[model samples]
Target: MGKLKKIETEIEGVYIIEPTIFGDERGFFFESYNKRDFQEIGILDEFVQDNHSKSRKGVLRGLHFQTEHSQGKLIRVIKGGVLDIAVDLRKDSATFGKSIKVELTEENRRMLYIPKNFAHGFLTITEEAECLYKCNDYYYPEYESGIIWNDSELNIDWELKKYNLKKEDLIFSEKDKRHQSFKEYKKAGGER
Candidate 1:
């Protein structure tokens, strides 16, 4: 098994993982994931799929989760960096409605774990960013759902200045731009 250090986030199920990297002037190497090592740190979920995406700075992609195949993601950046965000939505939990943000970059090699039932998203901070993540369940398009990234109630700081980005500079897909607000998502019982 690999050596991985787990750092707990403020939220109950989320975690920040620091993988042991071996490097020199020749470059570096590290095991991104090892099933046995992950379990030793309490990440028991079995990952069923791997996803990758590339985006430029100012691109904002989500606050989304699936109702049917809700995914718990282990996210990392392979090239460049981003501002990763996750919002707690499990109604019965004490930290419900809370959110956490972590700055992930290729140079840092840190990873964030977003348990199922939470909304997940990221804003690209570098000129270009490539993200890779593992999901615990298969995605079902019919179950795609999200909360608008700027919902006032969530109070996410976003930390746009890290990349000299302004509110007007962020880009979004048409669907992300039209997502439901926090109140609307809750009113529709999406939390349940």
Candidate 2:
């Protein structure tokens, strides 16, 4: 198992990392992240918070980020799989208003690094999915906020066309529904 590839995007501080996997009759193993290797690849974040979530299929978790104490995240799935998404919300970024989506699964051993000032979300693709992430800052409830996952302005192709998503299955908090869209959020100086 070795470092397979690093995909740097137009969005600053965003990356997709694919690690080499070695399998045998027993099982498979891979190095998820090595601090030295991360530094070499220019991912110099020192994560201080770790979060894990489990969700059933059709469960959608966000378009969430912090307005005050924003977090940069290194996200991946440990079991099953999900369609992970990151939307650029940084008002000053070149990629502002753009979004990137990727599939993450145990088999792929891939991870996404999302820098601060972006909204993060995922949709469970398997019967069940276990997602984990390392965050550069501790979560602050007061500062936590989100945009509607289906917001038209951002125009994220969640690729949910194949999945049978029910109204109940597309779960969200009341707050998420009311959160500002990119255009509105930007006009209100939502960027940090």
Candidate 3:
């Protein structure tokens, strides 16, 4: 349990998890997500699904969530790195419409826990990146929906140029490109 440190983000339920690493001439080792360590921080929900994804530089994959069965995700990068992002959507919360971003890399071995009711997404920062995550709920595409990534109202400040990538350099699915705006989400009554 002592091997993990959980740091709260400005957003109420988001957390940055750092694990103590033991390294030597050979390599390094650490418990990526120990149940005991997680329990110590009051994250008691059991993860029901594990997901993995690989993306090339300039690939951006979300701002998505399930409207009916929202998922809480614990995300980490293994092969390279990414700018992981989460946006709060709880209408009654102070941080609603706010966001938090973190750089998750192989070297840092850090992870982000994004609770339900937030949009989750990431941009691959290296030539390629491999991401793994545990989810508290299984995916249900029928209930899937998203807020558009570059909504003016959210003012996400993705800092795309800092990574030497421009908006045109990014790759997005037509579905993601057409996601609703934050304003639309609000008009629709937010989070079914």
Give lDDT per model, in order: 0.93, 0.83, 0.91
Candidates in order, TM-scores: namely 0.97, 0.91, 0.97
- On TM-score, the stronger of 2 and 3 is 3
lDDT of 2 by residue, 83-109 (tens): 999999877878888999989997777
Query: Which candidate achieves the best lDDT against the true structure?
Result: 1
Question: In candidate 3, how many Å is residue 48 off?
Answer: 0.3
lDDT computed for candidate 1: 0.93
lDDT of 1 by residue, 15-42 (tens): 9999999989999889999999999999
Pairs with steric clashes in candidate 3 = none
lDDT ranking of the models: 1, 3, 2
Single out the weakest 10-residue window by summed lDDT for candidate 2: 164-173
**Pairs with backbone N, CA or C atoms under 3 Å apart (clashes), candidate 2:** none
Please list the residue runs of candidate 1 whose C-alpha ends up more than 4 Å from where it truly belongs after superposition: none
Displacement of residue 143 (Cα, Å) in model 2 is: 0.8
CA RMSD, predictions in order:
1.3, 2.0, 1.2
**lDDT-better candidate, 2 vs 3:** 3
The residue-level lDDT of candidate 3 at 77 comes to: 92
